[model samples]
Structures are given as structure tokens and as C-alpha cells.
Target: MTPIGTQELDRELKKGSAELLILSLIEHRARHGYEISKLIEERSGGVLKFNVASFYPLLYRLEERGMIAGRWVEKAGQRRRRYYKLTAAGKEMLKTQRSTWRDFVHAIQVITEAENA
Candidate 1:
């Protein structure tokens, strides 16, 4: 079984947060899957890695949901790569999701504090 702890749970939350983060990134500029993975790792001080095992399914599912679109593009980098860009729906959805998640986390923290008090 997977061990759960503060950091582990935070990491778990990140998986769910991945969609919003990816949308936020694509809002700035489109990127291939690997690029998205790399940015998350870099921006998070190497803490967040959307490595292939964790990243691709999420990407494919987002495409399946019509939230993002992917296409193959040839690059100077070793070989061709599949890039992802946010769709109109993805932009709106991300805004809604980000707000909800923030509120949820805030509420949880508040309630937990009250209980402790």
C-alpha cells in the first residue's frame, strides 16, 4: 500500500492539480508533453516531475475530454514530439477548478484548525 503523509498527500493533490497547472502553463504558451513535464520539475525546484508514467495518461485523457489538443511536430530535439495546447474549454474549466480547489483547501484548513482549537 502507498504510505500517506503530509508531503505525500500534497503530492497526491498535485496529480489532481496537474490539469490546472498544465492549463496555466499552456495559457502562457503551448508545449509538448515532455516540455510540460520538464517545466513542472524546474518550476517546482525539481519537486514536481510529470514523468512519462504519470504524465501521458493525463495528457491523453485531457485530449479525450476535449480540454486540450495534441499534435505531432518535428523538432530539432532528437525526434518528433507530441505537443499539447489548451482548448477554449480547457481555459474556462481551469479557472473554475482552480477557484474550487483553493476554496476547498482553505475550508479544510479552517475546519481542521477549529477542531484543534
Candidate 2:
């Protein structure tokens, strides 16, 4: 098998965590696609970025899976936008994913620390 380069590894890691990131973002309130994208970029300090082609598909997939609910909102003098919020299933999934993520990170940290010792 071909080895994964740094860029490919980064992409894979981002893909693995994308659902968790999205769920956490909308846990409190609903957010439109653009808002979500910008928030992710800003919060990550531009280390992570998602364009329309890649992002919308993930949103659609989550909506289809019942993890998220999206509704169209029309504001005065503005185009209609679909805002997304976490569903009950999403909340449950988020809880589980967060726990798993913490455990995985801790394990990785332990291994790396031991290797450096």
C-alpha cells in the first residue's frame, strides 16, 4: 500500500472529525451554511477550511441521517438560507463522539510521550 503524505493524513483526520465539529458548533443554536463554514475557519485559526463543494455534501448527509435538522429561513431583503441545528440523535451522537475522541487523544498522547521518553 502507498504511504499517506502529510496532506492526505491531515485530510483524513479532518474528515474523521468533521461530524463532531459540526455537531458541536450547532449544539446551542442554529446556523446557516456560510456561518458554519466561517465559524470553523475562524475557530480553527485558518488551519482547517471547507469549500462549498465539500461542505454542502456533509451537511446534506447529516440531514439525511437525521443527525441534523435544516430549515429554510428567509430574512428581510436577503436570500433564503438553510439553517441547521442538532437533532436529538445528533446530541446523543455528539456525546458519544466526544467521549471517544477524548479517549483516542489520550491514548495517542500516551504513546507519543512514551516514545519520546
Candidate 3:
């Protein structure tokens, strides 16, 4: 079997996981784009990083789909930041996505274990 290059692997992982990452992060509380990106990087130990170009579009797409809601929040000293929170639909989506991801991982594990055996 041919081995996947690092770039291809990274791209595939990000494409599959980005929505789940964003939805899971905002599942608990609202977060701005930067915050969400930072959290994903931090939580993943810097394995995953999303630049503004890629990040904002995904956020907007989720918002457009009514999965998430974004509001501009202004603090006394800080500039206005658009924070995103999960909607009821997002919550349901999250549940389904989680199950799907788990099943995917399990299937991969089974295949790899068979290969090893």
C-alpha cells in the first residue's frame, strides 16, 4: 500500500475534524474565532492550527446553516469580538457527529489491527 504524505494526511484530518472541533468548543460557551483557534491548537498540543482564512469561512458556514449563532460583543476596553455559540441544532449535530467519528475510528482500528495480526 502507498503511504500518505504528511501534507495530505494533515489536510484530510483537518477537513474531517474541523467542524467537530469548532462545534465541540462552542458547545460549552461562546468563543471568538481567535479563541476557538487557539483552544483547538492548545488542546491538540499544537498538532492542529487554523488560520483566519480557513477558520472564519467555516464559522460563517456554520452560522449560515443555523448550527451556530454569532454576536458582536464589546467590552469596556477591548474591541468588539464576534462570539459564536452552539444552537439547538448544533447540539444535535454535535451528538451525531461524535457518534459518526467514533464509528469511523473504530472501523479504522479494526482494519489496522487486522493488518497487524
Evaluate model 3: give its TM-score.
0.93
Compared with the true structure, what per-residue lDDT tens digits does model 3 show for residues 15-92? Answer: 899999999999999999999999999999999998789889999999999999999999999989999999999999
- Candidate with the greatest TM-score versus the true structure: 2
Put down candidate 2 lDDT per residue, 9-96, tens digits, no spaces: 9899889998999999999999998999899999999988986899999999999999999999999999999999999999999999
Candidate numbers sorted by lDDT from highest down? 3, 2, 1
In candidate 3, the residue pairs with backbone N, CA or C atoms under 3 Å apart (3 or more residues apart, or in different chains) clash, namely none
Show the colliding residue pairs in model 2: none
Q: What is the lDDT of residue 54 in candidate 3?
A: 85
TM-score of each: 0.79, 0.95, 0.93
Q: Alpha carbon lDDT of residue 46, candidate 2?
A: 98
**Alpha carbon lDDT at 87, candidate 3:** 99
Q: State each candidate's clash count.
A: 0, 0, 0
Q: Kindly list the per-residue Cα lDDT of model 1 for residues 1-117, writing each as its tens digit.
A: 876999778878888789888888887677988788888889999777766887889989899999998889886766988888889999888889889989999998999899687
Which model is ahead, 1 or 3, in terms of lDDT?
3
